[model samples]
Target: MSLRIGQLPDRTPVKLSVSVEPDLACALADYAAIYAETYGAQEKPETLVPVMLEMFLSSDAGFKRARKALHARASKGDT
Candidate 1:
């Protein structure tokens, strides 16, 4: 019973600490404000940062290719 979709990945949450330049911090705050206005829901910049990063990583074709290659190598027991 092969399925097109693979098994779901782990959903455990990990906490990360990051530092940004003042200007970038301001930009994140502005983005959060715009997002709140667009969606009618308020979210802190900190809350949005990880989601934005995940979306960015998911959208990168090169990253996807490299990740796939790494997974294939790991599956093959290649160091």
Candidate 2:
């Protein structure tokens, strides 16, 4: 029997810990404030970090090429 709905992708969340310098911490807070002002929605710097990282990674050409090569190697079962 075929169903219209497909199996959902993994939604498990992973927690990460990072340390930043005081200046960078202050900058992140300022960025969060500007983000809230620009979008009229309040978001914590922690909440924005993953999204900002994803955006940066998606926009990086070298990372994209390297990621593609890595995926190809993985698919070929290369170490």
For candidate 2, the lDDT comes to 0.97
Runs in model 1 lying further than 4 Å from the true structure: 1-9
Worst 10 residues of 1 by lDDT: 10-19
Q: Itemize residue pairs with steric clashes in candidate 1.
A: none
Q: Write the per-residue lDDT of candidate 2 for residues 1-79, one digit (tens) a residue.
A: 8899998999899999999999999999999999999999999999999999999999999999999999999999995
Span of 10 residues, lowest total lDDT, candidate 2: 1-10
Q: 1-79 in candidate 1: lDDT tens per residue?
A: 9999999999999888889999999999999999999999999999999999999999999999999999999999995
* Reference-based lDDT, each prediction: 0.97, 0.97
- Superposed Cα deviation of residue 69, candidate 1 (Å): 0.3
> What lDDT score goes with residue 76 in model 2?
98
